[model samples]
Target: MDAQAAAPEQNEVPTGAKQQQAQRPAEDLVWIDTPGIGQRGGIIIKDLRLSIKNGEFVYLIGKTGSGKSTLLRLLYGDVPLTAGVGRVAGFDLRRLDEESIPYLRRRLGIVFQDFQLLSDRNVYQNLAFVLRATGWRDETKIKERILEVLRNVGMQGTQDKFTYELSGGEQQRIAVARALLNEPELIIADEPTGNLDPNTSAEILRLLLDINHRQGTAVVMATHDYTMILKFPSRTVKIDGGTLHEVQKKTAEPSDRAKE
Candidate 1:
């Protein structure tokens, strides 16, 4: 991304680019500025300020209870932003209501750590459900979209199989395909690789990176696998002490194991 080389230590905009970035709302897919975030009158995050530009892939890393999930929830409008400015794909987060949440999500693709595929539904039915919920009507168009996303995730021709009949990796691939069904501008992935084995985790990471590059979709993935971060370096942020910090990139030594 344009800001990778000059990432800030904190959540502030990179130096020398504030004037440039301040003027480009159209270029930023996610924009947030908030004093705090929480539920039930408790603050989990404080002084949060973050921006993710179009097509950028960013890793969100932090320990449990460090507010990583809370941050992602805020981005998707699951948690209301009680104060400050917050926007995602042109929707005002602070102003999001029950009626608008679905609309906001239609423009986003969300992947969960558990895969979240319905066990009772076949792959095609799972995908078709999302398309229909998002206002797709024609059966022909829905079928085409389902096949297209399945192909993108390298999981074609399994549309007839139940999700429970698939392996973990295959199931996750279907989940990724579901996230793509809407052609969303941004993908919010929360611990997408957490449940996979090492090799499968790498596969999922590579797939997300591929989509970020190929489709120009901004991705903000929260993960605990520092190993994956080492193997596939990218712009990353760490949530700590109720705030966010940019992690300096580290060069990884060549490893045959990582290659596999």
Candidate 2:
């Protein structure tokens, strides 16, 4: 599907306290309060409050089926907010509709545990396809953007390669590159390294950190890799029993991990 296609727009008013909270500055890429979200009439998470500031890197951790994925979906507008005040990438979550989804998405980039590249197309073709679908008419600009993103992810010369031909690590890098094509304000990564080896996972982590540092792109990454958390400590948030809580970092531990 074309990630940039326009959707319908709507606005919803939060009640009482939530309405007051929603009136605050929307500087953060994502802001929510006691939000209830789910799919198909089932509430996966409730009373979840969270905020992610610009250029911040937050690790979302939890056991399997603890609502990590559902929360990520909520941020990207895949799952509708059942109740509460929420805003993401300048769009009010409560007000989100089909017409505003694409605009909301354009301000953010999403990465998945599974690489969602087009198997039949070469790397360049895959990216070009997205750009074309999004209304890019200038061939020169499209090629430049593809090459720029590829360079950012260290996949500069692999544009001619097909998706099936690249290793898992390489494919993930391409995926990251694809996510960067629009220079999104926030990057929502859901277990982006889940399928890669340890070393490759570390490489992906380093790449993401580098992007966060250099481009000032805020990142909210849902992960199960506690080892990565220990290796590259940052602000950690845990989801349990359908609620979100900030995990305090251990003090008095000295290591080489970078600080946010």
Candidate 3:
């Protein structure tokens, strides 16, 4: 896919450019150029370009209201792209109809800060709900898939427990298992560690990294945890002053360690 520079104004919808970009072959899981994203009259993010390839782990860092969530929403079609080109999971953001949104989401797994598990249901029921909704018909297959994903996330024995019965870290592990149920090509984790303690947060991060390594699923995690970034450095993207900037990872020197 060709990359083009974009400079979009608020309230300007570059439909033409979006169409052109969508028609090109998608070499990346997500490719956007100066995408104006948000509600029609008010654009939260303007002229933002980002590209995330398969099997890549990227940290999206920005202060609250810096459009990190909005960008993630754009990828999953929660927010419409008002301008610029965006192709996510082979779906053209410009021409994505409501009917196609679910199909697009099937290729994506979203982990939110709040574990949005059904409070009234046990782990098994919660997972079964998603499988049923996604058109998994065979009872045996659904049961087997649930068991497999639970084992994958190391939460194999917690299936009969309710969400309230699990600790924060355990709940997060269940959430991760839920995301892995469909074997999504990309997992968009929006503050997955936000509600956990530091130790639990570290464990969650390690789980995500393990999933990325073993499953080859691209992970775009939006977080404010600088400590985690310093400890597990990778490609980092920051949103500041309404634009996206790639933060270079610097190797820690002996002096830096001493200061720590």
The C-alpha lDDT values of all candidates are 0.80, 0.79, 0.80
State the lDDT at 201 in candidate 3.
94
| TM-score, per-candidate, Cα-based | 0.86, 0.87, 0.86
**Cand. 1 TM to true fold:** 0.86
Model 1 agreement with the true structure over 1-260: per-residue lDDT tens digits: 11112222212323332322223377878888888999889998888889998887889999998999989998888889999988887777766777667766766889999988888889999988877766666777678778878889999899999987898999999999998877778999999988899999999988988887778888899999999887788778999988888895442322332253
Report the CA-based lDDT of candidate 2 relative to the real structure.
0.79
Candidate 3 error regions (>4 Å) = 1-26, 249-260
Cα deviation of 28, candidate 3, in Å: 0.6
Q: Which runs of model 1 end up more than 4 angstroms from their true locations?
A: 1-24, 249-260
Please write out the lDDT profile of model 3 over residues 1-260, one tens digit for every residue: 00001111211224543343344344598899855676657777777888888877889999999989988998899988767778887678877777677777777899999989999999999999987777676777778888888998889988899999999999999999998877788999999999999999988888888788777788899999999878877788998888888995553332332233
lDDT of 1: 0.80
Stretches of candidate 2 exceeding 4 Å from the true structure: 1-26, 249-260
Question: Which 10 successive residues of model 3 have the least lDDT summed?
Answer: 1-10
RMSDs, each prediction?
A: 9.1, 6.1, 9.2
Error of 3 at 228 (Å): 0.4
lDDT at 113 for candidate 1? 93
